[model samples]
Target: MINHPLECWLNLRMDRPLNSGSVSPEELQAWQFGLLRKTISHAVKSSPFYSKQLQGVVPDEILSPADLNKLPVTTPEDLRKNPNSFLCVSQDEVARAITLSSSGSSGTPKRLFFTSGDLERTTEFFQYGMGPLVGEGETVLALLPDSRPGGVGNLFAESISRLGAKTVYPEDPSDIPTILNLLLNSRASCLLGPAIHIHALARLWKSKRLPKNQVRSALLCWDLLPPVAIETISNTFGCEIFSHWGMTETCLGGAVECFQGSGMHLREPDFYLEIADPETGLPVPDGTSGEILFTTLSRRAMPLIRYKTGDLGQIISGPCTCGLSMRRLGDVKGRLDTDILLPTSEYLSMAELNEIILQYVGVLDFKVNYQQQSLALNIALDIAPESKIPTDLSRALTSYPKLSRTVLENNLKINIIIDNNDGSISSGFGKRLITSS
Candidate 1:
């Protein structure tokens, strides 16, 4: 492989190939297929679940996007019904066990096992993915949720320690105020956590005149980040902010954003990524939005092939300014389940709702639940004591049209619950439950 100076720089920052500023699309595709074949063959042989599923089938049978459909999609139910079936190693070989819920209200919890090698791979991803947006000797306070024994957080804590970064979790709501002070004086170079928790910190900084850029960067995940919030965070932190994509079932990440600011690069070497039709299991053309379908490339204890991520994104094949041979995803559009349908026949997604609420800046947090037939939109939010609802804000709803039309064209109503805290919002988990019945 030719060592372009730019390529070397990106490689140093990222463990996987990226849009390193001048990667050829053809070369990238070839690299993808080669890695895909090897990962599939290895998983099928070692993973108990995959071995039984692919029994009597040739690894070559999964030749293309279409051929993948011939194999059944993996569901959490399969794991719950027979958890041990996914094991690829014997009892003596298994090094760790982690239990996690799929985040689905109806899904059961799952246990995933990892050998030392799996942890090593995840550790490398952190060094490569988060390292670029970061500088050495900076302290990172992990706002990420504590994944108690055998959960994702435990792994993240281990990873953070490996990165030579210190971690801080509020652990209790009472600690938030104290956490705020530590961030101020700790001269902490980084703050890493979910968008909601980190955003609350930004609001606190906005009001308290806390030191900015004394912090190096913020690593955010777990919820849809509103564009307005991103701008506000960068301004308040006075430093770079980066985000990576991950899923509980897929072992942390599907991709990570680069310093280029173009889009997140798919960790193609670690996972076989494809955008597929949710109903038909067929590949969507590059650059078109569809469900994200993934196959684990780096797996030992458990390997999932052609797993439906339930996340939507676009695949880019054209040239990238940052330049790595691997593919880049246009964006991860949140869960397919976030969409809510009204009797007026309009559809609303959590992303759209977040954009609307954050635009006001007057709001801090809220709980939303749809009413029968969508006659009313009830919004619970924190607002200012002196401020009152602006009629124009209601009018802006139609700008998005489909959702706004329910109130505009139909008899639908909007009831906003604003508990104005003078700009301070409560800290909690699970997306603030914007929509509830």
Candidate 2:
């Protein structure tokens, strides 16, 4: 019942006993080194960006993973300023081009080019990564766009079809009723989308007492999924919830979680991942929180070497209870630049705030802002009045030491506003904006 040739290819690959985790450290290092050498050679010869960046560095000199530090780290600024220079192939050879908007003040977007082979690799990853949640003959409802070629939704749909499953994508994700109708009519067993959108739908489905149909699992992709959001969605839907971690720069399908829920297992064969000190660019020990850096091993159109992802997280090295030996990625704690500064020079991360605010029972969504010597927390509620929300939120903030000090010293005042507008909350794609001012 294989629907795509790549499905067979993935099945055969997965059947191999010598997977990333099964191999000895020496064997894995040797394999990674070989791939690294090839990637370095390809990038230096084909990509103008790498050629100039790797001027005096020789590919053969990078005999081990640590040797990667010999080359300069590639930053988002490099991609923004000279994107085409990173392409290993000509424009005609590219199958798709994706533009990722920069998070900086300039607001410039970085364009990434992918060849047919690159797209196929992504499709293959999706087919296998999604294997645990979806089964043959089941329908998967994707709440992402399908209008454009190579969009995450389109690629996901194609992969689901390849796995011998049905996929339904609503014409417009903003239309919640239509989306819910499609899910119910299709009897979709699996749901995949950004965490925020899925959270909203889960609440609506619960409030309306909607029929669950065959829905069994949900995969929250694209952005960080706070623990509160996960618990809420899973409780509302009465299903297992999984998290996926990927970025446009890596062709989107990177790491995914298994049913055991230990952590998001790394796609070790296709991409080499490293946790590095953001300030020093030196590799950090496993279990240490730091920036995520990666090297593309198999991409043909564009090969990014030592590319800094700017994501903040640690790598876990213990054997997963799920029987996976591949290193797992810890829960992403938001970006390095997403820290909120206080008047006392103390810091609060958006991830931390999200964990606290999302725990409040009637809180649907929220945003934070600092202005006029006060910190305002705008919240979207599933309930009315919103009078007790500010007091409730203030009490919650007291649980955090740094926030409590800020409040006690009167260095900052806490304010809460009820915002029903969709614009105030995130649209469930890209990075969540934590502060407006």
Candidate 3:
């Protein structure tokens, strides 16, 4: 738990009007229902897409969260098909436009628009979300893109500046020596970037044998931070590592981890989150893994009603030790589209594979390749030459009854190749694809 006085002081300073975590669930629901009605009315009247999507459904009819399912889901394909139809504001009124191509997409990319007020709300969320880790007089080194106006990096810098802190955004983050110099010279207290990039820098810092413990804290975004990666980074920098979950659709500001680090505290005041069956789109019981569906309650430019995020996770209820009443979300368990299919048609989630692989000693990184009648696991090990595959790992894999039976009944070939060269494993900004032909 965080220090009580400090948390209170930061909360007061941030002056967040919707710290719904501090209120009762009933109160939060009432607040959310009111916002939902208003958002629905606005979107239907302004956005051609929502106007057609919500045909015959009165905004007032959605009095409860469950009734929200009466509306159809807005999918990425829908956004890509005709993005202009989703816009509530005119093109001239748009403050920022972002084009993103989803993995495996070959057609037109999905476009998202945000007004100046929308961007300001995201910045405000960042300001409040980061208050616990960042404070006055500290320098935050942002390793995200900051050149474009109204981009995520620029908004992040603005938010830090609003909190009376200086920000350092590298023009080219690939240049390691330059970033090291900036970190050393500026005496930066907080480091924020994708997990892969931050891990790479930490390894580079260790390889150079630089002075120890320069950074005070680190916030990793964009990708999931494996336990080993978090441990290595924290050890290298001698700082606590935090994680945040969001997407471009949400303007890049969403749930964040408090000092407790149990789970990500949801930004319920701005968005209402629900866990639903990926196939049926019906709400699932709390703590049950399901697809994450969210509704934009405050967004003006492109308000989404029950948007299917494709990401997988569960909603955690109960009070947090940090004293925040907001609900939390479990660690994202990869995407639904990326699940690996077996010969027997059984699906293996990447999160399950990650949990098993990261526990082995001397394992640095790994990639999974699915080919004709075979599953190849290419692993990068930290061990020296002559070290063979651990017997314990073989036993652990076979111990999982489902996997063991599938491997035997289907006669599926499982090959494990251990490579000592860490460079063989590649990292990306978002979900890393493990499947290959």
Whose lDDT is greatest here? 2
TM-score per prediction, in order, is: 0.83, 0.88, 0.82
How well does candidate 3 match the true structure in TM-score terms?
0.82
What lDDT tens digits, residue by residue, belong to model 2 across residues 107-131? 9899999998888888888887887
What is the Cα-based lDDT of residue 116 in candidate 3? Answer: 89
Top TM-score model:
2
Of the pair 1 and 2, which is ahead by TM-score? 2
The reply for model 1, stretches above 4 Å from the true place, is 1-35, 42-48, 61-67, 147-151, 157-164, 172-176, 382-404, 408-410, 418-436
Per residue, candidate 3 scores C-alpha lDDT tens digits across 222-305 of: 766677667767878888887888888888877888863678877777788888998888899888899988899889899998
Q: Candidate 1: deviation at residue 61, Å?
A: 4.2
What is the Cα-based TM-score of model 2? 0.88
Candidate ordering by TM-score (highest first): 2, 1, 3
Give lDDT: candidate 2, residue 326: 54
**Residue 307 in model 1: lDDT:** 74
C-alpha lDDT score of every prediction, in listed order:
0.65, 0.74, 0.73
Candidate 1, residues 99-183: lDDT per residue as tens digits?
6665567677777777777766666666556655555556667765445655556666566666566555555432444567778
